[model samples]
Target: MAMLNPMPYEFLGVRHKPNLNNFFGFIYAKVTVPSSVKVPVLPWKDPETEDTIYPRGFFTGHYFSEELKAVEKLGYKVECYIGYEFSQQSLFNEYVNHFYEAKSKAKERWNFEFLTKEEAANKMFYTYAHEVVELNENHLILVSDTTPSRELLEAQDTDSVFVQNPLPQDIVGSGLGQFKDELK
Candidate 1:
C-alpha cells in the first residue's frame, strides 16, 4: 500500500499539560469500534509438555492512529505520549503488576492454556493497549520501544500495531480515571 501522510496518526493538544479528561470531548467524537473483535489464536500442543498455545490476533498501529484522528477532528487537541527510562524510577512497575494479574486471569480462564513467551507478552501488551484505548477514545497514547519520553515526541514510526508500555504517566492522568469513574 502507498504510504499516507508523514504521520497519518495525529492527536490534538488539549492543554499545556496532558490530562485524560482533556480528551473526553475528542473521544466522544472519534473513538468508535466494536466492543469485541475476534482475536486470532493458534492451536498448538507442545509435544514435550503437551501444553496448548494461544496467541492473540494482531492489530495494526494505524488503526489506533485513525481512532485518535477521529476524535481530534471532532475538536480535541491531543498528542501521542510515550514513557521511557526515567531518572526517578521504573515507570512500568504498575503496568507490569497489572499485566501479571491479567495474564494470570487469562491463563486460568483459558483452562490452563500455555503460550510462548512472546505470545504471552504480546497478548498482555495488547490487552493493556485495549484498556487504555477504551478509557479514552480521543486521547492517543503510542507506546514505543524504550528511549526517552522526550525522544518519542519526534518519533514517526508505525511499523507495529502493539503499543508497548510503561506508557507516559501523563497519558492516563485524571482523565482516564474520570472515565472509569463515570463507568462505575
Candidate 2:
C-alpha cells in the first residue's frame, strides 16, 4: 500500500479523532541483554496498584520511566528505537507483510545511492520489520533485525496514526483500521 502523505489542508478538514485502541507508534526502549546474564527480565511497575512485576519483555514504551529506573537499579543496558505495535494479530501480520514486500521491490528496482535522503528513509521503513518480535503472548513488536531482539514483558503505547477523515464509501470497509481481528 502506498503511504499517505496528508497535507496541512487535509488536517484542517478532519473533524473526528482516530480510534487508537488497537495501534501503537512510539519511541521504544528495550533492556539490553548482557553476556553475564543468561536471562534478562524487565521490572515493571503497575501505576494503578503501584506494584512492581517482572516480565520477559514489553510491547511498547509506556513503561519508559519504570524501565529506565529498573535498568539503572540493575546496572543493565537499555536500547531505544522507533517502534510500532499492533494488538490485532492479522493487522500486525499484514503490516509486516506489506513492508517486507515494499523492501523487496525497492531493492529490485532502485539502487539506494541514487535515491534522495527522504526516499531512502521511506525505503528504510520497509526494512524495519525484519526484526519484528511477537511479545507479551499476543502482541507484536517491530524493529530492525540488525539490532538485538527485545526481551521484556508487555506494554502498549496509546499514541498512533489515525485516519482523520472518512474513507470513500466504496473503500470504507476495505480501508485501513476497518478490518478488525480479535485477539485469539
Evaluated with TM-score, which candidate comes out highest? Answer: 2
Clashing pairs in 2: 56-152, 56-153, 57-152, 57-153, 58-152, 58-153, 59-155
Q: Write the per-residue lDDT of candidate 2 for residues 42-90, one digit (tens) a residue.
A: 6566777977765443432443333354564665655544333322223
lDDT of each model, Cα atoms only? Answer: 0.37, 0.42
TM-score of 2: 0.21
Compute each candidate's TM-score over C-alphas.
0.17, 0.21
The segments of candidate 1 whose C-alpha lies over 4 angstroms from its true place after superposition are 1-86, 112-184
Local error of candidate 2 at 95, Å? 2.7
Model 2 clash tally, residue pairs: 7
lDDT of 1: 0.37
